[model samples]
Structures are given as structure tokens and as C-alpha cells.
Target: MATTGITPSQDDRSVAELVRQFSEQTSHLIRDEMRLAQAEMSRKAKHAGAGMGLFGGAGLLAFFGVGALVTCAIAALSLELEVWAAALIVAGALFLLAGVVAMLGRGQTKQASPKPERTVENVKRDVGELKERHR
Candidate 1:
């Protein structure tokens, strides 16, 4: 047949040549898939890292905010109570608030999974396709 884009049938290709082509194409496919997985994982890792950084920043800012609030409250209350007593009460309350904020940030950081779930799923699908072709 003189078809413009038709491929030669199996009879036209030697077994060794077919094997070699198959091997080369399979290797290329695996490499391409790995590269894709790596890129996807990199993107996922970056998001996870950003989440952790934000959590850390929030915790730090919360502590600073609590300290500032405690200072302001202590100053205001010192008109009635002695300075040390007012400072102690404000410090204890503010510290509890700071602790709660820190815990919440920790929980959020823990929620961000580092796994590249999408990449794993794609690889699994590729493997399933290959198995189908084999059969």
C-alpha cells in the first residue's frame, strides 16, 4: 500500500529492531513520567512549605500581639492595683491567649500533607494502561 502515513506492519520489522524500539520508547516514557512527577511534587512541596512558613509567622505574630496587649492593659489597670499585681494578671491572661493561637497554627501546619498525591495517582494510571497493553 502506498498510503502516505501508514506504518509498516510487523512483517516489515525484524524482531530485534522491534524489541530495541520498544525498549527505547519504554525508557523514554518512564523518564518523562518521572520528570513530570518530580515537577508536580516540587510544586506541591512549595505550597506545603509556604503553609508551614505562614503558620510559623502567625504564631510569632500572635505572641508579639499578646505581649503588646498585655502591656497596654497592665498600664491601664495600674491606676487601681499595684503595678506588679496588675502586670501579673495581664501576663497570665495574655499568655493563655498566645498559647491558644500557637496551638491553632500548629494544627493547621500539621494538616498540610507533603505527599504528592496527584503525581502518585497519575503514575498508577500509567501503570494500569501499560498492564492493559500487555494483555
Candidate 2:
């Protein structure tokens, strides 16, 4: 009879080696995926920070805008009313503008909250399953 030299022990060892290699490859892939997620998260955080900064600038501009409006109001009232009454009216209008801006800023901040990433969640699930299977 013709002889084939494959042994059962050798075949089992080869299978184990293949599984170990596959596990290592999967782990490396997960690491790569995690790195990508972190990069994306950092980019998003930067963008959010920039947006917040812009909002702050806008808030500052709004303050100045309120000042301009008050100045205009005072100028208008100074034509007919007493100086103190004109200043009081301008102050009231500035307060109202400040309240509206505050509300708008609050809404924008609420909208800026970070959302969960699906890729990170999937990677976590995959790692958990792999660990459970190896055990």
C-alpha cells in the first residue's frame, strides 16, 4: 500500500497554530480599529471645541451689538427726553438682548453633546466574544 505521512498530532498542532495566528490577526485588526476611532474622536472634539469658540465669539459680538443698540436708543431719546431717562431705556433694552442671547447659547450647547460611535461599540462586542470563545 502507498504510504501517506500525515500524523493526527501534527494536524491538531497545525490547526491550533492557525487558530492562534487568526486570533493574533483579529487582535491587531481590533487595535487598528481602535486607533482609527480615537483619531476620529479627536477630530470631532477639535471641531466641537472650535465651534464652541465661534459661539463664544458670537456671544461677544452680540454683547457689542447690544451696546450699539443701546447707544442708538440713547441717541434717539437724547433728541427729546432727559439724559437719565434715555440711559434707563437703553439699559432695559440691553438686558432684554442679553437674556435672549443667553437662551440661544444654552440651546446650542445642548445640541453640541457628543454621540456614541458605533464602530467602537462593535469592536468592544467583538473583543468580548473572542475572549469568551478562547476561554
TM for every model, in the order presented, reads 0.52, 0.56
Candidate 1 Cα outliers beyond 4 Å, as residue runs = 1-10, 92-135
TM value for model 2: 0.56
Q: How well does model 1 score by local distance difference test?
A: 0.92
Write model 1 residue lDDT over 1-135, tens digit each, in one string.
Answer: 566674667468888998999999999999999999999999999999999999999999999997788788998999899999999988888689889999999999998889988899999999999999999
**Per-residue lDDT of model 2, residues 51-132, tens digit only:** 9999999999999997787788898998899988999888897789889999999999987748566777999999999999
Deviation in Å, model 1, residue 103 alpha carbon = 13
Report every candidate's CA lDDT.
Answer: 0.92, 0.90
* Candidate 1's TM-score: 0.52
Q: Where does candidate 2 stray beyond 4 Å?
A: 1-13, 92-135
